[model samples]
Target: MPATRALVLAAAVICLAAAGWLVLREATDPGLAAHPVPGMGEMNAAELSRDGYLVIPAMLREVYVAFGATEEAVIHDTLAAVAAGPALETLYLDRAGAMAGGGLDGADQEIHEMELLDLASSRDGAMLSVNATWRVLGTVGHAEHMHVRGNVYSAALTLAPTAAGWRITGFELLDVDRSDAGTMVAAPEPAEATGG
Candidate 1:
């Protein structure tokens, strides 16, 4: 009976240790603590703060909406409104032009979910990373009609305070996972990759 009691005590200790390890892992995960952007909700720019959590996500959403638009004027206006510095030039000159030239101008995309993965900020500048899932519901680059429900992208962005407000200065797309019919497809090889 004493041996049986010892075995039970050991089992309980192991279970407790496992539970403690899980708790610690969760506590240390940055994604678990990051803020989730409300889907398709309007964020008041006046309420945005440099040190607060809302600014990065809001600006990212604006960029997303602008890229999804079919009208060049809308894309130009939205990017101009929300971005400045290098980000503005890159988006307008490089990315938007690429989209039009690649036949992505007619595609319709919308971000259905977004998660802030990390953030760091100072008095004058800020940097953040985010993961967003967009629903793609139109043809892409002259391909047949496609509907991708889980097109996930990871991006890093930088922002600075300007007289007009917080303006995004940098944007880099890090990774992409394009989906087909709601199923996650394998990421393409580096040479074949096209990012958002």
Candidate 2:
């Protein structure tokens, strides 16, 4: 009976040591540093912040250059892809305007370049701010002939974290005409000028 008692005490001590080791590991390991909230799963605040910075710009570029018969399809697709919040929808309508019957038929745009200038996030990782630039060639509305214009624009987007992930909450943009600075090169001349 004494030998059996000793064996049980040894097993208990071993179990206690294992539990302590696991606790120490969770305390020290960076991977386990962020304690996930209930229902939040494995994603932590830092991961959410990084993903927010990375994904929002790419999605914005996609929405920007995505042209179709009407703005409806593009708008719907963009909203679906990003799952932007209501505040962002207002900004989208203001910036893209095509949703409000601003696009011409047969109009299409090509994004020549895109760059992320800056990215930042809130302390709680609930919000992210992003600055980016894009170079694009798009049709300019004219009754008789199609006119392709190349332009550069800068944008700032704010993101909010939601159960579905990061979503755009706000946006702003500044457009500059490339032809004015004589920097736009290798682009076809306006069809109206060529009478084509």
Candidate 3:
């Protein structure tokens, strides 16, 4: 009976220690510590401030995919929804408007990988530098189809606080590495340049 009690106590102590370890891990985890509440649309500024590392990458992916949309409405609306201020103007003037004669009619973009390289935050806003590996597939224009894969680029972005959420306020493309076989390479451009 005494041995049985000792065994039960040991088991209980082990379980408690495991639970405590899990709690400690979660508390220290940057991703989980700042994780925002999951919802239907974009996370707002407050949420972004809490967890820019997690939110910004996903947002960029959405913007990249939206750029490939053939419909002008989709292009404009998607950009407008994700960006504001200088960033929005850049997207309209440089990216969406710069489409070749036919635009990205059948173009599709895929982000193979994205990493948050750096982040700087202030009371009013934040900045991020990101590196991504992406590819574009399908016909972007007559004789201008894109088939690049493993293309890489780095982008610098500025975010400002807004009532809706943290909106992209500025964007700049820092560098690019095109694939050797790239035909019509498409890169992720800033303001110049996502998620629901």
Quote each prediction's TM-score: 0.51, 0.53, 0.53
Ranking by lDDT: 3, 1, 2
lDDT of 1 by residue, 5-83 (tens): 9999999999999999878865764222223223323322222333336556666667777877777788888887778
Stretches of candidate 2 exceeding 4 Å from the true structure = 1-44, 51-53, 65-74, 99-103, 120-122, 133-152, 174-196
Candidate 3 stretches with Cα past 4 Å from truth are 1-50, 101-104, 108-146, 179-196
For 98-183, candidate 3 gives per-residue lDDT tens digits of 56643555555554455555555433323333333333333333332345454555666776544455567787777765653346
Please give, for residues 1-196, the per-residue lDDT of candidate 2 as tens digits.
Answer: 9999999999999999999998997666543344322233434445655564456456666566444335566656656455467645764555467545544555444444455545555533345566656555555443444445566667666655555555566666655547632232343466845889
Could you give me the TM-score of model 2 versus the true structure? 0.53
Error (Å) of candidate 2 at residue 122 is 4.2
* Candidate 2 weakest lDDT stretch, 10 residues: 31-40
Model 1: per-residue Cα lDDT at residue 87:
83
Candidate order by TM-score, decreasing, is 3, 2, 1
